[model samples]
Target: MTAHVAESTITVELDGQVRVVRRTTDVPVRNVKANKPREVSDVV
Candidate 1:
């Protein structure tokens, strides 16, 4: 499954003008599950 999350942006003022130093973008997130370990063998 995939999920879209919104990110925040940062603004800064330099010289005498206000500008967006960092921009916001849509980030894709996914759910993950770890695999189960295999059972140990009695005979080695």
Candidate 2:
């Protein structure tokens, strides 16, 4: 449970002067499971 995005900056003026940019990114979510605990053996 995590979510955050509060950092931005963008200015453009091509063929003349200023051009500043800042785009952010952070993604890390990995729960690689190979049957951690999934037991189902009830055939009745």
Candidate 3:
């Protein structure tokens, strides 16, 4: 008796002509705070 293994592949088509492929992982994003308002300078 013999045993065999099967493999599969994936393909993507974009714009009907271009192919886009990517392997991505989860990434963390940081929250940014807005700057405080500055006081105006008075001219003499």
Candidate 4:
């Protein structure tokens, strides 16, 4: 049996077995301010 439950997730059969597939995506960086001060807490 085969089923597509969502846009990024799916279920299918391969090689006489059942499997679930999922999609992944990259995330953008945060707090990207130009000419920002380098605080002491950011010196990790």
Q: In candidate 3, which residue pairs get closer than 3 Å at backbone N, Cα or C atoms, i.e. clash?
A: none
Query: Lowest lDDT 10-mer window, candidate 1?
Result: 1-10
The global C-alpha lDDT for each of the candidates, from Candidate 1 onward, is: 0.50, 0.50, 0.40, 0.58
RMSD of each: 13.5, 14.5, 17.4, 13.4
Candidate 4 structure quality by residue, lDDT tens digits, 1-44? 54444466657776678778774633432433446686676565
RMSD after Cα superposition, model 2: 14.5
TM-score of 1: 0.28
For TM-score, candidate 2 versus 4, the one ahead is: 4
lDDT for each residue of candidate 3 in 1-44, tens digit (9 for 90 to 100) = 22121233224444565343342533432334446899999999
Q: How many clashes show up in model 4? A: 0
Q: Which runs in model 4 stand beyond 4 Å of their true positions? A: 1-5, 26-44
Which regions of candidate 1 fall more than 4 Å away from where they truly are?
1-7, 21-44
Expressed as tens digits, the lDDT of each residue in 1-37 for candidate 1 is 2222335544555576766544455553343454689
lDDT of 2: 0.50
TM-score of each: 0.28, 0.19, 0.25, 0.29
Taking the tens digit of each residue's C-alpha lDDT, what string does model 2 give over 1-44? 22222356445565666666664544442443334787989999
